[model samples]
Target: MLADYIHFMKDDFWFIVPALWFIGYACKRTPFIPDWLIVWILLCIGVLASCFFYGWSVRAIADGVIATGIAVFSHQIVKQTSARDQIE
Candidate 1:
Protein backbone atom coordinates (compact mmCIF):
# COMPACT_ATOMS: atom_id res chain seq x y z
CA MET A 1 0.00 0.00 0.00
CA LEU A 2 2.71 2.43 0.98
CA ALA A 3 4.84 1.49 -2.00
CA ASP A 4 1.98 2.06 -4.41
CA TYR A 5 1.31 5.51 -3.03
CA ILE A 6 4.98 6.39 -3.12
CA HIS A 7 5.34 5.20 -6.70
CA PHE A 8 2.43 7.36 -7.85
CA MET A 9 3.44 10.43 -5.84
CA LYS A 10 5.59 13.18 -7.33
CA ASP A 11 8.52 14.31 -5.23
CA ASP A 12 8.24 17.89 -6.48
CA PHE A 13 4.82 18.19 -4.89
CA TRP A 14 5.97 17.38 -1.37
CA PHE A 15 4.25 20.52 -0.15
CA ILE A 16 0.82 19.28 -1.18
CA VAL A 17 0.44 16.79 1.65
CA PRO A 18 1.14 19.34 4.34
CA ALA A 19 -1.04 21.89 2.62
CA LEU A 20 -3.88 19.42 2.50
CA TRP A 21 -3.21 18.40 6.09
CA PHE A 22 -3.72 21.96 7.28
CA ILE A 23 -6.73 22.35 5.04
CA GLY A 24 -8.16 19.14 6.42
CA TYR A 25 -7.56 20.37 9.94
CA ALA A 26 -9.37 23.58 9.12
CA CYS A 27 -12.30 21.69 7.64
CA LYS A 28 -12.39 19.39 10.65
CA ARG A 29 -12.68 22.29 13.06
CA THR A 30 -15.41 24.05 11.15
CA PRO A 31 -18.87 23.30 12.50
CA PHE A 32 -20.85 23.71 9.31
CA ILE A 33 -19.14 21.07 7.15
CA PRO A 34 -20.07 17.50 7.85
CA ASP A 35 -17.31 15.04 8.66
CA TRP A 36 -18.01 12.82 5.67
CA LEU A 37 -17.50 15.61 3.16
CA ILE A 38 -14.00 16.52 4.28
CA VAL A 39 -12.31 13.80 2.24
CA TRP A 40 -14.20 14.76 -0.89
CA ILE A 41 -13.35 18.41 -0.37
CA LEU A 42 -9.71 17.52 0.10
CA LEU A 43 -9.81 15.31 -3.00
CA CYS A 44 -11.15 18.15 -5.14
CA ILE A 45 -8.59 20.63 -3.90
CA GLY A 46 -5.74 18.15 -4.11
CA VAL A 47 -6.58 17.08 -7.65
CA LEU A 48 -7.03 20.63 -8.87
CA ALA A 49 -3.87 21.86 -7.21
CA SER A 50 -1.78 19.04 -8.61
CA CYS A 51 -3.35 19.47 -12.02
CA PHE A 52 -2.43 23.14 -11.91
CA PHE A 53 1.14 22.21 -11.17
CA TYR A 54 1.57 19.29 -13.58
CA GLY A 55 -1.07 20.19 -16.14
CA TRP A 56 -4.30 18.24 -16.56
CA SER A 57 -3.57 14.54 -17.03
CA VAL A 58 -4.24 11.12 -15.54
CA ARG A 59 -0.89 10.97 -13.80
CA ALA A 60 -1.46 14.33 -12.17
CA ILE A 61 -4.79 13.18 -10.86
CA ALA A 62 -3.28 9.98 -9.48
CA ASP A 63 -0.54 11.92 -7.78
CA GLY A 64 -3.07 14.24 -6.23
CA VAL A 65 -5.16 11.37 -4.87
CA ILE A 66 -2.08 9.67 -3.46
CA ALA A 67 -0.98 12.88 -1.78
CA THR A 68 -4.40 13.40 -0.27
CA GLY A 69 -4.48 9.79 0.92
CA ILE A 70 -1.14 10.15 2.63
CA ALA A 71 -2.23 13.33 4.33
CA VAL A 72 -5.47 11.85 5.60
CA PHE A 73 -3.87 8.54 6.55
CA SER A 74 -1.15 10.25 8.54
CA HIS A 75 -3.69 12.42 10.34
CA GLN A 76 -5.69 9.36 11.33
CA ILE A 77 -2.59 7.60 12.58
CA VAL A 78 -1.76 10.48 14.89
CA LYS A 79 -5.31 10.85 16.12
CA GLN A 80 -5.65 7.14 16.73
CA THR A 81 -2.39 7.03 18.61
CA SER A 82 -3.46 9.85 20.91
CA ALA A 83 -6.85 8.34 21.49
CA ARG A 84 -5.38 4.95 22.28
CA ASP A 85 -2.94 6.48 24.73
CA GLN A 86 -5.73 8.25 26.50
CA ILE A 87 -7.81 5.12 26.66
CA GLU A 88 -5.10 2.92 28.10
Candidate 2:
Protein backbone atom coordinates (compact mmCIF):
# COMPACT_ATOMS: atom_id res chain seq x y z
CA MET A 1 0.00 0.00 0.00
CA LEU A 2 2.79 2.40 0.81
CA ALA A 3 4.59 1.50 -2.40
CA ASP A 4 1.42 2.12 -4.35
CA TYR A 5 1.06 5.51 -2.71
CA ILE A 6 4.67 6.36 -3.50
CA HIS A 7 4.25 5.42 -7.14
CA PHE A 8 1.12 7.53 -7.41
CA MET A 9 2.86 10.54 -5.94
CA LYS A 10 5.87 10.17 -8.22
CA ASP A 11 3.73 9.91 -11.33
CA ASP A 12 1.25 12.66 -10.57
CA PHE A 13 3.55 15.29 -9.10
CA TRP A 14 4.04 17.02 -12.46
CA PHE A 15 0.51 18.35 -12.24
CA ILE A 16 1.84 20.94 -9.84
CA VAL A 17 3.88 22.65 -12.57
CA PRO A 18 0.85 23.47 -14.63
CA ALA A 19 -0.93 24.62 -11.51
CA LEU A 20 1.90 27.04 -10.78
CA TRP A 21 1.76 28.20 -14.37
CA PHE A 22 -1.89 29.03 -13.94
CA ILE A 23 -1.08 30.99 -10.81
CA GLY A 24 1.64 32.92 -12.63
CA TYR A 25 -0.76 33.71 -15.43
CA ALA A 26 -3.32 34.94 -12.96
CA CYS A 27 -0.71 37.17 -11.31
CA LYS A 28 0.38 38.53 -14.67
CA ARG A 29 -3.18 39.21 -15.75
CA THR A 30 -3.99 41.08 -12.59
CA PRO A 31 -0.99 42.97 -11.38
CA PHE A 32 -2.89 45.18 -9.02
CA ILE A 33 -4.15 42.43 -6.77
CA PRO A 34 -1.86 41.99 -3.80
CA ASP A 35 -3.91 39.25 -2.24
CA TRP A 36 -1.73 36.37 -1.03
CA LEU A 37 -4.82 34.14 -1.02
CA ILE A 38 -3.90 33.33 -4.58
CA VAL A 39 -1.29 30.96 -3.25
CA TRP A 40 -3.93 28.79 -1.59
CA ILE A 41 -6.07 28.91 -4.70
CA LEU A 42 -3.13 27.80 -6.81
CA LEU A 43 -2.37 24.90 -4.49
CA CYS A 44 -6.00 23.83 -4.69
CA ILE A 45 -5.78 23.87 -8.44
CA GLY A 46 -2.68 21.72 -8.24
CA VAL A 47 -4.40 19.26 -5.95
CA LEU A 48 -7.37 18.99 -8.34
CA ALA A 49 -5.12 18.32 -11.27
CA SER A 50 -3.15 15.78 -9.28
CA CYS A 51 -6.37 13.98 -8.30
CA PHE A 52 -7.64 13.96 -11.89
CA PHE A 53 -4.42 12.37 -13.02
CA TYR A 54 -4.20 9.86 -10.16
CA GLY A 55 -7.85 8.58 -10.24
CA TRP A 56 -8.46 9.47 -6.62
CA SER A 57 -11.35 11.87 -6.96
CA VAL A 58 -12.62 11.92 -3.40
CA ARG A 59 -9.22 11.95 -1.77
CA ALA A 60 -7.95 14.58 -4.13
CA ILE A 61 -10.84 16.92 -3.48
CA ALA A 62 -10.55 16.56 0.26
CA ASP A 63 -6.81 16.93 0.20
CA GLY A 64 -7.05 19.95 -2.03
CA VAL A 65 -9.36 21.65 0.46
CA ILE A 66 -7.08 20.72 3.31
CA ALA A 67 -4.05 21.90 1.39
CA THR A 68 -5.68 25.25 0.77
CA GLY A 69 -6.38 25.69 4.44
CA ILE A 70 -2.85 24.74 5.29
CA ALA A 71 -1.47 27.13 2.71
CA VAL A 72 -3.36 29.99 4.28
CA PHE A 73 -2.26 29.05 7.74
CA SER A 74 1.32 28.64 6.67
CA HIS A 75 1.33 31.87 4.77
CA GLN A 76 0.25 33.79 7.83
CA ILE A 77 2.82 32.03 9.93
CA VAL A 78 5.56 32.88 7.49
CA LYS A 79 4.48 36.47 7.29
CA GLN A 80 4.47 36.79 11.05
CA THR A 81 7.83 35.12 11.41
CA SER A 82 9.39 37.33 8.78
CA ALA A 83 8.04 40.44 10.43
CA ARG A 84 9.40 39.34 13.78
CA ASP A 85 12.77 38.48 12.33
CA GLN A 86 13.02 41.84 10.60
CA ILE A 87 12.54 43.64 13.89
CA GLU A 88 15.42 41.83 15.54
Candidate 3:
Protein backbone atom coordinates (compact mmCIF):
# COMPACT_ATOMS: atom_id res chain seq x y z
CA MET A 1 0.00 0.00 0.00
CA LEU A 2 2.79 2.39 0.94
CA ALA A 3 4.77 1.53 -2.16
CA ASP A 4 1.76 2.12 -4.37
CA TYR A 5 1.24 5.55 -2.79
CA ILE A 6 4.88 6.42 -3.30
CA HIS A 7 4.64 5.38 -6.93
CA PHE A 8 1.54 7.46 -7.47
CA MET A 9 3.22 10.45 -5.86
CA LYS A 10 6.19 10.12 -8.17
CA ASP A 11 4.07 9.65 -11.24
CA ASP A 12 1.42 12.38 -11.25
CA PHE A 13 0.05 13.23 -7.82
CA TRP A 14 3.03 15.46 -7.05
CA PHE A 15 1.53 18.31 -9.07
CA ILE A 16 -1.85 18.08 -7.38
CA VAL A 17 -0.33 17.92 -3.91
CA PRO A 18 0.84 21.50 -3.88
CA ALA A 19 -2.41 22.71 -5.33
CA LEU A 20 -4.40 20.93 -2.63
CA TRP A 21 -2.04 22.26 -0.01
CA PHE A 22 -2.53 25.79 -1.17
CA ILE A 23 -6.25 25.31 -1.20
CA GLY A 24 -6.14 24.22 2.43
CA TYR A 25 -3.86 27.08 3.34
CA ALA A 26 -6.11 29.60 1.64
CA CYS A 27 -9.15 28.14 3.35
CA LYS A 28 -7.70 29.33 6.63
CA ARG A 29 -8.30 32.93 5.60
CA THR A 30 -11.98 32.60 4.87
CA PRO A 31 -14.44 34.24 7.30
CA PHE A 32 -17.65 32.51 6.31
CA ILE A 33 -16.88 29.25 8.08
CA PRO A 34 -15.23 28.27 11.30
CA ASP A 35 -11.48 27.80 11.05
CA TRP A 36 -11.62 24.11 12.03
CA LEU A 37 -14.06 23.29 9.26
CA ILE A 38 -11.93 24.63 6.46
CA VAL A 39 -9.34 21.89 6.34
CA TRP A 40 -11.87 19.10 6.69
CA ILE A 41 -14.03 20.47 3.91
CA LEU A 42 -11.07 21.01 1.64
CA LEU A 43 -9.89 17.50 2.37
CA CYS A 44 -13.21 16.05 1.25
CA ILE A 45 -13.09 18.15 -1.87
CA GLY A 46 -9.55 17.04 -2.57
CA VAL A 47 -10.52 13.39 -2.30
CA LEU A 48 -13.53 13.85 -4.55
CA ALA A 49 -11.36 15.67 -7.07
CA SER A 50 -8.86 12.84 -6.98
CA CYS A 51 -11.64 10.45 -7.87
CA PHE A 52 -11.92 12.24 -11.20
CA PHE A 53 -8.41 11.15 -12.03
CA TYR A 54 -7.89 7.90 -10.16
CA GLY A 55 -11.47 6.67 -9.85
CA TRP A 56 -13.34 5.68 -6.70
CA SER A 57 -10.61 3.70 -5.10
CA VAL A 58 -8.78 3.66 -1.79
CA ARG A 59 -5.67 4.96 -3.47
CA ALA A 60 -7.45 8.10 -4.54
CA ILE A 61 -8.61 8.91 -1.04
CA ALA A 62 -5.29 7.92 0.47
CA ASP A 63 -3.40 10.12 -1.90
CA GLY A 64 -5.71 12.98 -1.17
CA VAL A 65 -5.21 12.54 2.59
CA ILE A 66 -1.45 12.27 2.25
CA ALA A 67 -1.30 15.40 0.15
CA THR A 68 -3.51 17.25 2.59
CA GLY A 69 -1.43 16.08 5.53
CA ILE A 70 1.76 17.27 3.89
CA ALA A 71 0.29 20.68 3.22
CA VAL A 72 -1.15 21.09 6.71
CA PHE A 73 2.00 19.85 8.38
CA SER A 74 4.20 22.20 6.40
CA HIS A 75 1.89 25.12 7.14
CA GLN A 76 1.97 24.39 10.86
CA ILE A 77 5.73 24.02 10.83
CA VAL A 78 6.22 27.37 9.16
CA LYS A 79 3.75 29.05 11.47
CA GLN A 80 5.35 27.64 14.59
CA THR A 81 8.87 28.40 13.45
CA SER A 82 8.03 31.95 12.55
CA ALA A 83 6.30 32.50 15.86
CA ARG A 84 9.33 31.17 17.72
CA ASP A 85 11.69 33.34 15.71
CA GLN A 86 9.68 36.46 16.51
CA ILE A 87 9.76 35.60 20.19
CA GLU A 88 13.54 35.20 20.11
Candidate 4:
Protein backbone atom coordinates (compact mmCIF):
# COMPACT_ATOMS: atom_id res chain seq x y z
CA MET A 1 0.00 0.00 0.00
CA LEU A 2 2.77 2.41 0.90
CA ALA A 3 4.56 1.65 -2.33
CA ASP A 4 1.57 2.96 -4.27
CA TYR A 5 2.19 6.39 -2.81
CA ILE A 6 5.92 6.44 -3.56
CA HIS A 7 5.46 8.04 -6.97
CA PHE A 8 3.92 11.03 -5.24
CA MET A 9 7.33 11.84 -3.93
CA LYS A 10 10.88 12.03 -5.21
CA ASP A 11 13.98 12.33 -3.00
CA ASP A 12 15.03 15.61 -4.51
CA PHE A 13 11.48 16.89 -4.54
CA TRP A 14 11.02 16.31 -0.80
CA PHE A 15 12.54 19.69 -0.25
CA ILE A 16 9.38 21.28 -1.54
CA VAL A 17 7.48 20.28 1.60
CA PRO A 18 9.77 22.14 4.04
CA ALA A 19 10.06 25.07 1.67
CA LEU A 20 6.31 25.34 1.55
CA TRP A 21 6.17 25.24 5.34
CA PHE A 22 8.47 28.23 5.63
CA ILE A 23 6.61 30.04 2.89
CA GLY A 24 3.35 29.38 4.64
CA TYR A 25 4.82 30.77 7.84
CA ALA A 26 5.84 33.93 6.04
CA CYS A 27 2.38 34.24 4.55
CA LYS A 28 0.83 33.77 7.96
CA ARG A 29 2.88 36.64 9.33
CA THR A 30 1.99 38.97 6.47
CA PRO A 31 -0.72 41.47 7.29
CA PHE A 32 -1.79 42.11 3.69
CA ILE A 33 -2.64 38.54 2.69
CA PRO A 34 -5.88 37.13 3.97
CA ASP A 35 -5.73 33.81 5.82
CA TRP A 36 -8.04 32.02 3.40
CA LEU A 37 -5.93 33.02 0.46
CA ILE A 38 -2.74 31.57 1.89
CA VAL A 39 -3.74 28.03 1.03
CA TRP A 40 -4.52 28.93 -2.56
CA ILE A 41 -1.28 30.83 -2.83
CA LEU A 42 0.59 27.86 -1.46
CA LEU A 43 -1.16 25.52 -3.85
CA CYS A 44 -0.27 27.63 -6.85
CA ILE A 45 3.29 28.04 -5.67
CA GLY A 46 3.61 24.36 -4.88
CA VAL A 47 2.49 23.33 -8.35
CA LEU A 48 4.79 25.83 -9.97
CA ALA A 49 7.72 24.80 -7.81
CA SER A 50 7.06 21.15 -8.51
CA CYS A 51 6.94 21.82 -12.21
CA PHE A 52 10.13 23.79 -12.03
CA PHE A 53 11.92 20.93 -10.31
CA TYR A 54 10.22 17.89 -11.82
CA GLY A 55 9.25 19.27 -15.20
CA TRP A 56 5.70 19.79 -16.37
CA SER A 57 3.81 16.54 -16.04
CA VAL A 58 0.68 15.17 -14.43
CA ARG A 59 2.82 13.47 -11.80
CA ALA A 60 4.49 16.73 -11.00
CA ILE A 61 1.12 18.30 -10.39
CA ALA A 62 0.07 15.39 -8.22
CA ASP A 63 3.27 15.59 -6.19
CA GLY A 64 2.69 19.30 -5.71
CA VAL A 65 -0.80 18.72 -4.38
CA ILE A 66 0.38 16.00 -2.04
CA ALA A 67 3.36 17.98 -0.88
CA THR A 68 1.26 21.04 -0.15
CA GLY A 69 -1.28 18.94 1.66
CA ILE A 70 1.46 17.40 3.77
CA ALA A 71 2.95 20.76 4.65
CA VAL A 72 -0.33 22.35 5.64
CA PHE A 73 -1.56 19.30 7.48
CA SER A 74 1.67 19.04 9.43
CA HIS A 75 1.48 22.68 10.44
CA GLN A 76 -2.07 22.22 11.63
CA ILE A 77 -1.19 19.13 13.59
CA VAL A 78 1.59 20.88 15.44
CA LYS A 79 -0.49 23.99 16.01
CA GLN A 80 -3.47 22.05 17.33
CA THR A 81 -1.35 19.86 19.53
CA SER A 82 0.29 22.85 21.13
CA ALA A 83 -2.99 24.67 21.58
CA ARG A 84 -4.55 21.64 23.16
CA ASP A 85 -1.78 21.50 25.69
CA GLN A 86 -2.32 25.12 26.58
CA ILE A 87 -5.97 24.45 27.31
CA GLU A 88 -5.12 21.82 29.88
* Top TM-score hit: 1
> All candidates' lDDT scores?
0.91, 0.57, 0.72, 0.87
Q: Write the per-residue lDDT of candidate 3 for residues 1-88, one digit (tens) a residue.
A: 3344455442677667678767766776777778889778768877777777899898788877776666666677778978996777
Query: Model 4: runs farther than 4 Å from truth?
Result: 1-7, 86-88
TM-score (C-alpha) between model 4 and the true structure: 0.86
Off by over 4 Å in 2: 1-40, 85-88
lDDT of 3 at 6: 55
Task: Estimate the TM-score of every prediction.
Answer: 0.89, 0.46, 0.75, 0.86
Sort the candidates on TM-score, descending order.
1, 4, 3, 2
Quote the lDDT for 80 in model 2.
91
lDDT of 2 by residue, 3-80 (tens): 333333344453455456556467647968566657756766767765776667776665554444444455566679
Error in Å for residue 43 of model 2: 5.4
The Cα RMSD in angstroms, rounded to one decimal, for candidate 4 relative to the true structure is: 2.8
Candidate 3 global CA lDDT score:
0.72
What clash count does candidate 4 reach?
0
Off by over 4 Å in 3: 1-10, 86-88
Winner by lDDT: 1
- Which residues of candidate 1, in runs, are more than 4 Å off? 1-4, 86-88
Q: Model 4 misses residue 74 by how many Å?
A: 0.4
**Which scores greater on TM-score, model 1 or model 4?**
1
